[model samples]
Target chain A: MNDHDVIDNLAESDDCLFCSDHIEEAALGILEAEDQERFEHHLSGCSICRAELARLDTAVQLLPFAVNQIEPDAALKLRLHERFLQERDAEPTRIPSPRKSESRIRGRKAPSRPMWTFGSVFAGFCVALAVIGLWNLLPSNESSTSMSGRNFQVYAMQSSDDQSGGHIGADPDSKDGTMMAWNLDPSEKHEIWCVDHEDNRWKVDDLVVADSGSAMQTVTFPKEISTYKQIYVMRNDGTQELSVAPNQAINGDEPAPSESTPAGD
Target chain B: MQSLAEGHPEAMDLLYDRYHRPVFSFALRMMGDRDQAEELLQEVYLRAWRRASRFTDARGSLISWLLSITHNMAIDEIRKQQRRPQKQQAEDQTELMISLRADGISMDTHAILTERRELVRKAMDQLPQPQREVLELAYFNGLTQREISELLDTPLGTIKTRMRLALRKMQESVELQSLEAT
Candidate 1:
């Protein structure tokens, strides 16, 4: 067919200028502010335009079907599942500030320790109290806390700066754990993670560093701490191992026991 | 998807198995590279998993939303590289229809969707080449009508006409197929 005949065959009404102008962009969800506002405004009372948009939307959505189907690598699914697991388990805990009365009596002795608290639980409590006291000393309002339990073993986190340190604890019986880090690079977000014996990384949370860069933050995760061979801090993209527990690797090139191994192993 | 939002890993596995091939296929066509499509596929599901809680029925169906992610990611990569895809040779229409019809040989997940896909493919095949080209550019590449006009060197008015006509034809095809089924 000639170009003129083709044009004759295909020419359509531009009478609905808003529909003609905005439908494609709107369907793609890429309309600019003025155009987007104008399009929506026009749609409020125009059934024809709305109907046209719905038709265009269905066509766009169905475009995927035109491509010949191909399966993605199986490993990709595994990776995404692992990432999702980490995200699911690492629920960020927003630390609430202590009441004003507690702040006023920073100098006063901490209330008598609970009689039942002892050993690691007692030690964790004292550390928490000391951290709270230190937080009270800082000008910043945010602080972190932990759930008290004797099953929790606290690991002292060592960073380059002596003044900056934090504690991580996990219950061997339950896969639940808490991580608190201080003296991080305040300007950048620091992500906390735990590497299992198999070297699979689980992200704990992305902690936004306060202005002090040294501000302390805490996150809780539902993971058995013993499964993880070590804990560390890294940049948002997981670059740069900023700090670590055990202060060093257990030993170079030694294959650790698998995750399914017996507890004694 | 709701189960995924509730942090059930099995939901993710099932959802992945059902949709991964289609999602990967769409990405592969847009990206023109298997490796890149695979990477985009991984990113798409990861984003979906993280954002499942935000998905609601108001946004349309799950497949549409998933394809939208595929489109956006592919377009982003295209823009980053400042490269336009080389115009592709058209697929053999007979072969396409034959393969689509033959898709029913095995019992697969989302059987209803497979039938719908076959109908959409047939409708898409009926469009004139120019009309199909404009529609694909706008749909798969996330291009505005003006951008498509510039890309194809067609007059802006002609591009709009082709797009509108193409949608009308496809919509009619879908309606006709539904009627036939009934």
Candidate 2:
């Protein structure tokens, strides 16, 4: 019988011991096709077996635990990744420009053929992606209006736990830099860290995103910017809100430092 | 889990890293051959990526959901490759209860898994040999109760009873362990 054709609580529901005996097998996916269909048809009509099956389902879920688990070969991971790229067509998504009125604080020209794009197309992510591309292309930190050269390396922040955002223009030759940031939760105290390869952290400055969800700050680091491996924007509690490896503009695949790292966890 | 449906690659990558071991382990156990298990693992993740939006957290945890997909695909792959349900006895029934140590999991999680495995091992030990053989034949080797009944030269009704008893005994054993711990 079709499931819809099976009436609920059939007059025979109470006497479904025969079908109820099969609930565990059915839950384990071991019933033959015809037996499975018959069991399901009966299950639709029999409330008793349905309840038994509910309990049996939990028991059956435990069956995998009965087997000793073996770790698959590590190379299988790379093979699986290749399959994902092939199966999904993994085409990099193009970012559409924000409308003229939707534009925010400053007019930074978006770059063509940006290397990395976030799977999310939220306006904030797009802005960060664009600047990451543009910053890498620019010869120096200079407005087209002035054409003055500051020779800064762009460090664009990638958002992690929250929707917090930031883009920094740092002089690769020195410790001085300018930061344009947005979408930060204002209540938390935000700190910046410049970390070196030896796992050293320098508490350079506090990047305060105002109540308006954006901030601009001219920063002077305690150490030369070139010496650090990554610059992190984090909460005072050391929970990393966003992280960026130095020179984010060169490539989009640069790994950001860890995020939302609780002290003991 | 909702993060996966957000179409965020980072979220999917994060989840894949967390659960791949269990998923690969389950597929490896089911497929019984390393190459086949690896292929099945690739297909399972590919399916998960494509169908993340259809998965609802209210139904089950992501690991169980991933395993269900793995089981379904493995079964189909077995049939497609013309492999029938296992026709022989398990080489080592003890192997079924072998060590399960998943690296990178928290100690508490590892302990829970360890305890669960211990309870099941103890439960299997408690079962009559006939009942343990029947359960093993059906579960690890993918034999249906009918197939097991025929393989063991037992009546179908008897096989059903043994299977039900075995599962009930396992649940009882787990609950008993939990109660004793308290």
Candidate 3:
């Protein structure tokens, strides 16, 4: 045999722990002398390997400590057990009925529209017009809160055409005085503008035209503003305008009763 | 152990009772939170319940299987928290040294070895950082060398070497302490 063959044979001891492949094939115990010797040698010289082995040994030792009899809250356990039994008993009888399944399938095929859709769409358009018209017509309101300890009322404009007058006061409780208005004409472009109640300044945030039927845009006030008084929706074409005051008419074109009157709950 | 495949609640309860504490404790030590340990324990049991039919007696004892589960769950939870365990404080190191010296011997013997434990602790403290980490991970975290490699982002061979070195140093420290006591 060649010198390389002899050296390979000498290193390939049956008892060598480092030769895990041999150990696995032989089904030898971990504590075999070959394994122990290799481990001892490695332990003294190899810090990284020694640390890993130590961690493994610690984990093995700690396994017993991890086992604990976990008694969940007795009441909770009992309740869950009772529920399980009840569900187990009821499961068979509650199988889906044939008629119910048929109805479910039919329902999925043809969904119905609610009556409010048409009215809301029309109202949405009117509100959009009122918002824009009122924007140029009304002077912006400047109402600041007092530094004293009393809470003050905040307002914004909300215009909708569903009601005959097509105008309503903005929701006072809306923490942010933001509102939305839409244009009814699908082909016409619409603009949404916000009026800062505190600063009495108006800024156009968005302008978009409706593609098919109706257009809608939401306008939000800056976070710095504590309250708002009005929102206006105007046509980019400048044909019609719509607005909602904090508690007044939808558009400044008409004098309407202050919508801010609170109702007794 | 009863056959877990029979859907017997009693068998499940027995299995849970047998393995819950060790698993919980291991998880607690690994995670350092009672709530997380409890949660992990429950998840381990629930998984065991679901996969009970797959278990076989030929591979190893039920304890080893449960331990494997606990180790995986605890490691996962620890990873999720993204926490690295700080090195033990000097006082804790001293305390551990005392415990190692006492070796669960008699109370009187423990009292005597307490001072010597401080020396052992110092010796352990002198070990290289990697060796110390491997020793702690092995003894306290119960991670296999493979798991340790993944957790520490080191190769398995490297972990094994570190463990061997740590233990050898510990053995040396122990022998020296014995000589001093003599």
Docking class of 3: incorrect
Lowest lDDT 10-residue stretch of candidate 3 chain A: A21-30
- The better-scoring model by DockQ among 2 and 3 is 2
CAPRI-style class, candidate 2: incorrect
Clashing pairs in 2: none
Top DockQ: which candidate number? 1
| Candidate 1, B18-110: lDDT as tens digits | 677678778877876667778888778866765575576686878778888778778777767767654432432122322322322234445
lDDT of candidate 3 over A73-115, digit per residue (tens): 2243244334434433432211111223355435453222211
Query: For each prediction, how big is the interface RMSD?
Result: 6.4, 5.0, 13.7
| Candidate 1 TM-score versus the reference | 0.52
Superposed model 2: Cα runs more than 4 Å off: A1-11, A14-18, A90-265, B84-109
What is the lDDT ranking, best to worst? 2, 1, 3
- lDDT of model 1 at residue B42? 75
- TM-score of every prediction relative to native: 0.52, 0.52, 0.31
| Per-residue lDDT of model 2, residues B1-182, tens digit only | 45644455566566666666667766767777767778888877776765565566776666667877777677667656766543322532344432334454456545655665676677678888888887776665667887888878989989988887777776667667768989
